[model samples]
Target: MATATIPGPRMPRAMQTLGWTSRPLPFVERAHAAFGDVFRIKIGRDTFVVLADPADVKQVFTGDPAVYHAGEANIILLPFLGHKSVLLLDDAAHLSQRKLLLPPFHGGKMRRHVGLMREIAEREIAGWPTGVPFAVQPRMQALTLEVIMRIVFGVDEGDPRLARLRTRLTHFLETTATPREMRRLLVNGPIRAERRRIFASLLDPVDAVIAEVIADHRRRDDLADRDDVLSMLLLARHDDGSPMDDAELRDELVTLLVAGHETTATALAWAVERLTRHRAALERLTEEARAGGEEYVDAVIRETLRLRPVLPFVGRRLTQPQTIGGIAMPAGTKVAPSIHLVHRRGDLYPEPMAFRPERWLGVRTNPYTFLPFGGGVRRCLGASFAETELRAVLGVLVSQVRLAPSQPANEHVGRRVITLVPDRGGEVVATRVAPDVAMPSAA
Candidate 1:
């Protein structure tokens, strides 16, 4: 019946803050090395109780969602995700919204987007600065955004509205999701208000565009046969036969837009960067794909996600008093399952630092240990959609494009929002393979 203090660095708060913001991976690795599985670290005004052990991670992820409120811990994302966004809801509300949204991104429903993904990737990659070095992350972002707008929103590819909306979205995402912005929002009052004002101004047009799209969908009778997510969402009814309202629909659309695109873009960039560096893996993936199979491609993606998890941490906050990792967690305490550290644990992964896709051959990975998509109730709703996109994009690119790192040095990890991005934006030169060997024309 006693609360035990979590052990961590005795270093000054300033140093901890510095390490967390500037270089999170090394900061976490050092903390876990010094304090073992569970430790405490401060970022801005928050104190995070970090856990890397699989047992602790399972408890945090699989525990009652009522007790561990993912929504509360993600308050920073609320402005971007919107007031009614499913990502910011808890318990019953969260469950209801999730049920409404899951069908479009699940099983067979999600596989329907593969052709869209392949088409987007092919068109975008066709224009890559071939025979010259360029950052592939921007290209990847463009490709994923196009897929989201077309496949998720039902937007026409060449529509002027689509272009205008993309500009606004990129501006909103770039302006808001940064470490400086997060810290300022946490602690700075005046700046935060100014930011809120600017953010509202930026968001208004984007909201308007989404509303127009939803309205247009309502007017159109030809959509019942459509496979796009927006169409499905428009037609979807709850258990009691209620459909999402205009605001709810728009918020969820924005949620899918932001959440669906950037994370996959970052993951794809890392996959390319990793594959180009590891020749054997690259060869195996290419050969496997050429043989009319994607088993090795799946392995490559699995390895990429494990090595460079898009979100460095999966966060949750306690709603009531509970014990985690044998340490007392009072209500309102923040906890982060360190995805970065757990993926690199020597026990879970042999040669944890190396990029070896074969490690997955005939291997069964525990979901808690290999959680790039997270676990349980709050796991990413678009997990299957994202995986399918990655596989489609990777299969196409690996077969048609011959690519390698622009510089001899390895790409360093960089932070954007909460995702780890490739340094210099996964810089590489892409060239076409021989005509006979070019990726089979996008289906």
Candidate 2:
């Protein structure tokens, strides 16, 4: 029997899974067209009551944490993120970890990292091949990874340790993102215990390096003097005056590493992809970049994230029978707020399909309507850090080089694990480079 009372596609679950894996946006859009704002989707053994309306989304985000278990809904990520990860914790545990993790990502701290971001971005942007079509996503990935390595991991660029970990992690992440691996994950959507063990074994190499890093941090006498996230975390004390253990640090560090870099890189790739297609926005952003004004640059990033959100949905599993959108759902039913759907609603955004940065200029968008980072208490912890990275990278990129789309059409979305990435990896051709831009210095 169908677990959901809401109307949705009556297709065989296999067909629904195929559509979701291959063409998520279209699949959701088709359902929304046929079934209006709220719909049901059955994937594997779970039934997700997907919510598209902002009002309904608001209710879910603002709902009592005990009832709407975000962490329980994110259990599939447990193996990759570890059992102690803030992403895998709920209620008080999640809140306590959130408080500890909050300081380093605060607004002032993010600003301190902008110079490093611009330097890394400038160095990477300088090396982009000119007058030839090439995918920018890989380069963006490299750039963001380096940023996370330095700013979050506290690893210096030239260190042998950084090179080793970076190489291993890049391979690990890319391997997991392959179509074969993605399909395997989809088939193992429930992430059974054996599958989790397999996932953990795969992380053994990366975990070895993280263990080394944690040991190094402990040995450092100047931990309190360092501004990097890892250092602050080492020095942070719980409300009970207890320091986080090695296992907790390892889990949190890995969580930040995976979540912090990849998503920002994907967003930057999309920024280049979108800007290259929109001449006016590109020119305005470049001009703003060179003039040291960030208003338009910020707007461009806001619009890009809105249209190409890295993650399509934020999920909360019902802990008890609860009514949402006036429809009751049983315990363990997943209610997903569709970020992709709400961003495209015509009622909320005129010409939502069109890329329009000007729409955000000098406007304070309603939190529910413009939640690219998700909303309420469960909003992404790295939200500000990601935005800061984007602004710095995009600003540095546009100021240094001129980019144009290699293909006439915009790049189509492709699935990468849980993220939606550019199908062609955001292919583009750099036409011009500023002579002043310098290659990365070994310093």
Candidate 3:
């Protein structure tokens, strides 16, 4: 059995209460300072072991899959994502699902989508008049939704159902991230009358759409090799020659669509805000993008990912008793590698918060020290796809528009559901830098 060692000063009830309330960052920061790299905190019945140490993070994240499972950590998402969703699967199931989904996001496949990404980004930015204040999050979300719709469903933005689905899906994700609602649900069971009302409002429409898509696919008996993700999923068969059932297909599709677009959109919006706040970094990014090299643009994207990880924490449940940083944690305890905190560790990143793209130019940091898409078998399947789209989209944005934040810098960080979104919705004034460039393709 693992032994427990209390580290530093015990957390005051005030700080513990704050962890259960609205602001978690302050409690997290306080814990880091008082307890060094690792510590344990209790929020109601959940005891979360937070680790910001690089070695421990790597061990917990990339260690044996059977021992550290994400399915246990992400239980909250299961109701919406379904039991078979990749996020909730582990071991062989995760491996098998990952293999089936790999082809769509492979290097060759991702390169083909660059032109498509560039086109959507350019077209979206063109719609914003010079000096007009606009919300960047919604715009990015729309553009990403369009791209994902085309790739996943092989449908154009003009499809009436697409618009409705986007609206409903966005509302659902936003509702799940509400601090007050989330706290209530965490403390109480999800069966509460109010929680059910909100969840039903968002989920009903999505289920309808998923059912419609499945019905459409079933009607087509002449299904042959097709380019979209749906087609790939349809054609996939297990090693035993059993195909995925309709329920499984629906869960996987919804998971990919939501996970693929939402996080990338949030990351892109945050990247824009960061660039607007730091003029030096923005100028360097602009210059590098204009110069046109894979390495330079990649640097900017990497630095942005490092600074503001889309999914800030990768959670796992300890299957075996373990000690981290001299703190003993028992089996079934919740362990999270605080990616945001780890990325900001002064030891791993010099002047961590400063937006310096040059850090990634030639310098080598520990792989575990910078995990934007996570690590190990459960790593994000859409990571390659997201990177390709982000770099391509940002490349086009920088080349054509100069974006300035419309709100104060300090107020930029806001909470949208679980996502650390821009408080002002990333409101910005965008002016077209080059009118001569043909509007980017929307397909």
- Per-residue lDDT of 113-158 in model 1, one digit per residue for the tens? 7777888888887788788899988889888888888988898767
Candidate 2 lands at a TM-score of 0.94
* Residue-level error in angstroms, candidate 2, position 22: 1.6
Number of the top-ranking candidate, with lDDT as the measure: 2
Model 2 misplacement above 4 A: 179-196, 436-443
Which tens-of-lDDT digit does each residue in 303-412 have in candidate 3?
88887777767888877877766677787767888888888889888899788887899766466888888877777788888998888888888878888888756443
Query: Count of backbone clashes for each model?
Result: 0, 0, 2
Regarding lDDT, does 2 or 3 come out ahead?
A: 2
Winner of 1 and 3 under TM-score: 1
lDDT of 1 at 87: 88
What does the lDDT come to for candidate 1?
A: 0.84
Model 1's TM-score against the true structure: 0.95
TM-score of each: 0.95, 0.94, 0.88
Q: After superposition, how far is residue 33 of candidate 1 from its true place, in Å?
A: 0.8
Residue 423 miss distance in model 1 (angstroms): 1.4
Model 3 CA deviation exceeding 4 Å by range: 1-14, 17-23, 157-160, 174-201, 218-225, 363-365, 407-412, 437-443
Candidates in order have lDDT scores of 0.84, 0.85, 0.74
Candidate 2 least-lDDT 10 residues: 434-443
